[model samples]
Target: MDASTVPGILDQAHRRTTAGLLMLVTFIAFEAMAVGTAMPTAVAELDGLAWYGWPFSAFLVASVVGMVVGGDAGDRRGPRVALPWGVAAFAAGLLVAGLAGGMAVFVAGRALQGLGAGVMVVLLYVIAGQAYDSSLRPRLFGAISAAWVLPALVGPVLAGLVTTHASWRLVFLGLLPLIVLGALLVLSAGRSLTAPDSPPPPARGRRWWAVLAGLGIAALQYAGQRLDLPAVPVAVVGAAALVAGLRPLLPRGTARVARGLPAVVASRGLLAGAFFGMDALIPLLLTSVHGYSPTAAGLPLTAGAVGWALASQLQGRFARVPRERLLRLGFVLLAVGLAATVLAAVPALGGWPAYLTWAVAGLGMGFGMPSVGVLLLEQSPEHRRGADSAALQIADVTLSALSIGLAGVLVAAATQGLLGLPAAVAASIAVCTALALLGARLAGRAAAPPRAAVPGAGTTLAAS
Candidate 1:
């Protein structure tokens, strides 16, 4: 390619492609935020109180499977094949859920949606890796983070309005057409994008390992949610399954957080687990302890999103900063923010502190998440990018599910009078804080070794 022909993300050469990718992310973000707001009403109307958790759990578990499949397909073929199918599945799921008359049907639809979302996300990473040059990635990722800001601010409100004035089903149904448009944009761009032909065969039997890994993650999440029952035995079995299934799917040394790529991936899981766990609990804390209304309790979430977008912009602007340093700083901020949020459990502190504290945690996420994405691209070879992206996302979703489940158990115990509400909240906060701190420690190891080769770029993987 001629130097003059190389185009930036915003240039005419790439504008349509960038718009399409951003639109996809925006819609997904809206669905996630909107569904959370509408879920209580949806469940109540369906009279599915007993199965209230399954909608989310099913989506998360199915996503793991989608990630593995997408990774394999993208590596074997290309995003062109995987992406369109994912979009179709996602749209189908939306229609199913929107039209469903029962919670069981709704949960199944959510599982399908999760599968589609998982595949789409992994493919997006692959697309970004291939579509943009190294110089453009930070800006591209920043733009993607910016796409979340609008949804975070308005999705809940819009969903609430639609649910109250119209129907909860509209929330799901309304997104279908927009998703179709996004898919078209992606497919059009994919036609013009150049990608390597099918690579050498993948490791023999890897797909089976991927399947087992997905099942293990789902089983572990199920067991975590069932902690109220035979806690020890269920947890033990879940752990065993998770280990056996996860070991082969991840890069070597991921369990021990080896230097470079493995540590980067491990840090992503720890950061997401700690951050999202605390995020899920915030509204509960505000409503239960501070006596705020649902709408009012969600204000902090909006503020957090603002902080996240701002930090993401800052990180992109200062692209020369070492990604490892940014990740470390982000984790430290998250730990401090979570630690401060625990203080909100005190009656004397009042609810206002959360608006500020949680924003700090969001800022941390803003810094760390994009940095991790950049580092992953830096470390990965062309052929392995899809698989590595899958591993990164798997860690994120699995750890987040586990964290939320544990928090639920603690909250449940508190409701049952086994522990005080304050104690339960504090304990959950402590666990998340510890994870953040541990991630901070590991951030240093996330840096790629000096002179590491970019795979398929005609360089050897020799460390300086």
Candidate 2:
């Protein structure tokens, strides 16, 4: 490639697009972080502490459906048509959520936000795939990962301050204008892009499957929150629903981890499941066992995010290294980090070890996550980019929900005297570490052989 033709992410032609994409990701990250911090206060003010979990569950369920719809729309009409509408929906949801008077209204608003976010995020990946060279993709993903850093560090704290002094509503409402600005920037840059000449073969029954999958995820989340025998039945039903719905939505052979694209998709699930499961539990372990304050406990999470950002930046510089190799290295690092983290549960060691150990794990995620995105793009054809991106995200969200649910079950068991708190923590870490190890073992399968490459501007997967 000629030097003049090789456009960097921040070069004049791509600079506005990159900025807009990062801005959108940053706003989403901020909202995600801020909601957890603000939720208790919001629920209390609404006099609906009982319905606290519904807001989150609603979002998760709706997002799955949105992803399917968005992917289909992107493929048929292009991201230009879908992206602005997604932003508008997200902004409207924010408005509704900010002005909500009841728990029902709040949950409804959250569902809207989830749907919009789901659509917007998938379309973002499609835009990246369409607009940039494959060589530039790693850096684009690195920038997206880095965009989470500021939000991870300060979003919760800012939300807390807002909720304490002003109102929790501001947490939702404050980003409206910024979201609009990002949409406008992307819209301007998007003018140069084009849609497919004709829509790909229609995906029969995929939308319905997406809805079923969403409900399944919500049921699982609800079951995780419940602490009684009734939870068992709910969990079983959820699992059945998830299994049925997920098969149609994902690539063929994904469940069995077939080589190439299927394995790449499966790897995402394993990576997310392991990372997020531990991410959700570590703070609880520190606060409950080590007696650390919430702020002190959260420092480790911030450290992890920082490590993730640093590692992502480093990986983006080494594009020649096979992505599958980087992915394996990441999983190994994550497994080691998780294993070391178990020591934090030991009374003799204290929680200080977590700050360092989790940072190592974060480094693993930094490398692994972006590689997954890049690999997915490399394997998918232009027409299928949106659908394939949606599949990758589905795997991530599904596995994350399941892993967290499993951890929750163990925690509930500890509360019921079935095990000690330390035992529960140890068990959860063990499961997540095993998942990371599994990811490492299967990482090689994620790569397509050189001969399998399709000759086109976009890469296509070979069915191995």
Judging by lDDT against the true structure, name the best candidate: 2
lDDT for 435 (candidate 2):
96
Residue 159 miss distance in model 2 (angstroms): 0.8
Worst 10 residues of 2 by lDDT: 455-464
Q: Which stretches of candidate 1 lie over 4 Å from their true place?
A: 1-8, 192-195, 202-211, 220-231, 450-464
Cα lDDT of model 2 overall?
Answer: 0.88
lDDT of 1 at 155: 92
For model 1, where is the 10-residue window of minimal lDDT? 455-464
Regions of model 2 farther than 4 Å from truth: 1-4, 201-204, 450-464
Candidate 1: Cα lDDT at 407: 91
Q: Give candidate 1's total backbone clashes.
A: 0
| lDDT, candidate 2, 1-464, per-residue tens | 34358668999878888899999989988998899999998999999998988899988998898888888888888999989878988898899999999999999999989988989889988999888888999999999888966799889999999999999999999999998898888889878556788777666578889988888988898898778989889988998888888877787767777777788889999999999999999899999999999999999999899889998898899889999999999999999989999988987778899999999999999999989889988887778888888888899999999999989988988988999888999999999999999999999988874644424322332212
Instruction: Let me know the TM-score candidate 1 reaches against the reference structure.
Output: 0.91
Residues 1-464 of candidate 1 have per-residue lDDT tens digits of 34346556778767878898999999988998889889999999999999887898778767777887777777777888778888987898899999999999999999889888888888888898888877778878878877867798999899999999999999999999999898788788767444456564655465566556666666666665654567667677766766766666676666677777877788889989998888888889889988999888888888888888888888877767898999999999899899999878886687788899989988898888888888889987777677788888888876887898789888878888899887899999999999999999889989986554423321111111
Q: Which residue pairs come into collision in candidate 2?
A: none
Q: What is the lDDT of candidate 1?
A: 0.81
Clashes of each: 0, 0
